[model samples]
Target: MEFWNDIAIEKSWKVLIGLRKEIDFILIGGWACYLLTHTIKSKDIDIIVDFEGLEKLRKKHPLKKTPFLKKYEALIEGISIEIYVPFYSVFAIPPEEIQKFSIQVEGFRIPEPEILLILKQQAELARKDSVKGQKDRVDIINLLMNSELI
Candidate 1:
């Protein structure tokens, strides 16, 4: 439950920013909560990009997929980043909505609150179904209640 401090978050933002021109990406999950609320402890940063973007990165560097997570990870300067291409149905956010809420981080814009919430809600449901998504459920509930989105 250790969330990144502003400095660390900024560093991570820089990493995403550095790749902006080559990919379409968005910050999501707990780390995104840190960015929006500045009150949660997050262990990892979750980024949702397009599959084409994944291929683009693969063409340039080595990235290994993490088993079961549908994510790939690469350490940039000692920090591990988890990247994935979100399935539209699972995420429940349209591309246009994502673009509307995206905010610039180091020059690369990321999904805004609305789109992030949609994904969080979907993830929560997925977790609830598995009985292992309690954390996701709790996080989503907390966010929705606090943000009055529920």
Candidate 2:
């Protein structure tokens, strides 16, 4: 299980690095949970890209907006890349503050576990639906457990 998980992460890193678009964004959501908890699995990568940054990406690659999910998406190498725009409105975290807590991974920046947990809590609350909320709850629990906080 661990070996396959490592292989999946390796593939994800390659796909991320292959993107032609400039990645000036902060990593968030499920992938953030995986980054924090090495054993966690994520089927998609979520990032909070600045509006302007996403616009620039649109110029280079096809991006479709998903109103229901409140994110812009582009499929790359069979991987779903969900990009959230306007940092403040989505996560209520200023770009500068996000930068402070971000760590560079394979040329990309990822949020710290603490920030990811806060984002997951907000997501869990905002998603009134039980099904969607369950994912966030699981992510929070996984993060807490892996971090030895609970």
Candidate 3:
């Protein structure tokens, strides 16, 4: 299990780097929390990208458009990328303003720790019974207790 986790963690970061190489994005969701709090490594990637960035990603990967969900989904190296767009994807914060609320970290962009906490709390509220919801809980507490953003 540990070995597989290490592999999963490695692949997650690799996908992040590869996505960075492919297009500009603001990292959101659990990975951003992990980057700040170092509590949990995310299983997938969640990012906010503009139309041009989305186009670049489309050129590299097949995108599944779920307009109802207001986002796109793609798979890379067996890891999932949930791509949210401005004015389309709804969140605790608007997608367009996500950039304004973010900060640059080691060449990637992530939301402010306080913003991340809000995002996580919203996510937890939406699905408080599932496995990922459980993760959201852990992330929320970690963000409050361990993250410097608060």
Candidate 4:
């Protein structure tokens, strides 16, 4: 499987454009940041969408659907994408809060850098009970420090 860092910016653009209508929320991660700010190597595209919308999307795109709430990894024209519903905590973030700041991608707007940093930090803190806590912590730190969030 190709890592997120292995995907090109144009490929990310294609995927985002392809999925635009179905996407209610997109938290650009990994190499996707290049489209918004600067380029940085990242392993996976961490995306979140409204659970209800995702369910409807799954039903509509049955051929592309996977188990609910689990990472659905697939390659479309050689570009890898990882999809999943955000945890309740992440989803709990009010849309208004997210709307307060966002970046545009092909006419579709997504969370801004600061919001992304906040969410990543929340994800890191929430990982305390998980086996991957350390990795999450490191990722959160690196992303927060390097991204334009600050």
Residue 94 error, candidate 4, Å: 4.2
What shift in Å separates residue 141 of candidate 3 from its native position after superposition? 0.7
Better of 1 and 2 by lDDT: 2
For model 3 the local lDDT of residue 140 reads: 89
Q: Report every candidate's CA lDDT.
A: 0.63, 0.70, 0.86, 0.55
Per-residue lDDT tens digits of candidate 3, residues 1-150? 121277888898998988898899999888898888777788789999999999999998999999887899999989999999998899978988877889987788998888888888988998999888888898888888887865
lDDT for 67 in candidate 1 is 60
lDDT of 4 by residue, 27-136 (tens): 55443344444434444355656677567556655324455534555565555666555543233365445655677754656577666666556656766777345545
TM-score of each: 0.57, 0.69, 0.93, 0.51
**Between prediction 2 and prediction 4, which has the larger lDDT?**
2
**lDDT digits (tens) for residues 1-150 of candidate 2:** 332256666666666656524657787877667666765556567777777788877987788888776678887666778777664435656545776888764455777777777888888998848765777788888888886435
How do the residues 39-148 of candidate 1 rate in per-residue lDDT, one tens digit apiece?
Answer: 45354566767778778878876788876765688776545677766553134675545656777633435566667677777777777765325656655655666543
> Residue 22's C-alpha lDDT in candidate 1?
62
Report the alpha-carbon TM-score of model 2 versus the true structure: 0.69
- Candidate 2 error regions (>4 Å): 1-14, 20-22, 66-70, 92-96, 105-107, 128-132, 148-150
Query: Candidate 1 or 2, higher TM-score?
Result: 2
Order candidates by lDDT, high to low: 3, 2, 1, 4
Superposed by TM-score, candidate 4 places the C-alpha of residue 3 at a distance from the truth, in angstroms, of: 6.7
In the predicted model 1, the residue pairs found to clash are 3-41, 3-42
